[model samples]
Target: MNRPHYILLPVNPYFITFSLACAFLLNLMPWGRLIGVPDFVALVLLFWNVHQPRKVGMGIAFFLGLLMDVHDASLLGEHALAYTLLSYGAITIHRRVLWMPRGVQVFAVAPLLVVAQLVPFVTRLLMGAAFPGWGYLVHGFVEAALWPLACTLLLMPQRRPANPDDTRPI
Candidate 1:
């Protein structure tokens, strides 16, 4: 049986930057305390780190984390450290993670997301901040659950239609 081939379009750096900025903005929106909202910035960072490691890595993560710190009014450097670690994890497993199907990728990313959440939690605890309660962890799970959606959305711009008339190799 023959299989159809698809081409992946080149990704624009500006698009990546724009998407990250949008995620940061989404994270800053007030969604109330009752619902567990996923960390949009972190999710976008992780997605880019995995799919475009050369373009988005630890530096972006750190900078975004600092932005998050300022926006949320949380302990300084707390999110920076978490995002740096999260970037490391994503870069480390990017090759392997990308080989998996979308559903399995969620499982692969869950631990990294947990680590991103844990660093801030631990930092706050050490700084004498009271435990924010188990509810905090719910966001990480929500982020993990939304991984597939994020991946699909981000990849949309890079997906190219296969042309039957074109003879280029896939």
Candidate 2:
């Protein structure tokens, strides 16, 4: 079976900002501080970084990181550092990942997502915080699992149906 290729329309800057804002807001929701809640901002950020690197660069990631830092009230630069690295890694391999099947792409990015989560874990550990449990790391993979849905929803506005034969944008 062949993967469907999309000829996406130019993404609107406003839409990007709006989506980021929505993701941030989602992260703000109180889920009893659940470990499995997923870092929604990171998910959306990586998506935009991979799909629209030029528009959503590291600076945006850094800024969002700062916002998350303030919200989380953890180490000041923890999220900034993690998000920066995540953005860098995504931008680095975006070309290859984009060409990959979604399932394969999940495996490719899972490590990156784990590392992104690990940065803050190590940071807290360095500051004398105790282990947050392995579930913390598992959250990264949980976030990574959302990749396919994120790609579909995020790309929806930009995607145009190529043909009747193709049911969804691969």
Candidate 3:
């Protein structure tokens, strides 16, 4: 299908942007110790990578990760590399993942979340941050826990095209 049809298909770009924004806000929220949640950007980017690969891809993930790196004031390019790999990973498995049930999808995502966290952790370690300790792994767990919630919130009517038949945007 053409690009316009893709835009008008089942996912709206506006909603996608909003969803990512919300995830970003949530990530930015002051949660103290509870902030150990996995990377929200990874979750949202993976979802869109599978559901709407053409719209959300590695570039967005990289840019967002860079922004997050700046916000977190951590090593440069650490999260960027992680997100870039994550985006590619999601795209690689998008088709297979789409065919799985919701529960199975959740199971599938757990590892991705784990690996996503591991990548940055290892990167930081390489950059001379000392071992971040197991506490760092907690974010992966929290991220897994939050996946369903993220999916539920982002998988809203606003994100999906209003009309299934109107495959071309007005």
Candidate 4:
């Protein structure tokens, strides 16, 4: 059972920005308050961080975080802080992560997502907010579960065609 190996082309910077924007908009949907709703921004940010650390770094994460923070109307830096840390973690493991199959990568990325989400939770608690309950933790795993699907969709633009012609060599 060999999966097709794709030689990915260089990613477009514009595409990266577009995907991040889409992810941010996804998060802005009204379903966010529900338990176990995956954080699309975190997932996409981590995806790029894992795949292209040079092109997408913590600075971008910070900017996206600030935007999300404003939209959520929580602590000004809550999302920013979590996203930056998440970017750092992803960049740290990017090399190793790229070598993994999609299934294995899910496990590798799950802990980072969990910790990233935990940052805001802890921050809110420290700032005198009431406990949000244990369900909040499930969102991380939910994001993790979306890893394979995200990888397929996000990498689509960069993937070389399955049938390559002589002139279209990857």
Tell me the tens digit of each residue's lDDT in model 2 across 63-157: 99999999989889999999999999999999999988998999988988999999999999999998888888887989899999999999998
**Deviation (Å) of 86 in candidate 4:** 0.4
- Model 4's C-alpha root-mean-square deviation from the true structure amounts to 2.3
How much lDDT does each candidate structure score?
Answer: 0.87, 0.90, 0.77, 0.93
Q: Identify the superior model by lDDT, candidate 1 or candidate 4.
A: 4
How would you encode candidate 3's per-residue C-alpha lDDT over 45-117 as one tens digit per residue? Answer: 8888878889998999999889888878888788888888888888889898866766678777777778888
Error of 4 at 1 (Å): 12
Judged by whole-model lDDT over C-alpha atoms, candidate 2 comes out at: 0.90
- lDDT per residue for candidate 4 within 79-122, as digits (tens), equals 99999999999999999998888899999999999998999999
> RMSD per prediction, one decimal?
2.8, 3.3, 5.9, 2.3
* TM-score computed on alpha carbons, candidate 4: 0.92
> Which candidate achieves the best TM-score against the true structure?
4
Greater-TM-score candidate between 2 and 3:
2
- Runs in model 4 with CA error above 4 Å? 1-4, 162-170
> Cα miss at 135, model 3 (Å)?
2.3
TM-score for all models, in order of appearance: 0.90, 0.91, 0.81, 0.92
Instruction: Give the Cα error of residue 101 in candidate 1, in Å.
Output: 0.5
Which whole-number lDDT from 0 to 100 does residue 126 have in model 2? 95
Q: Quick one: best lDDT, which candidate?
A: 4
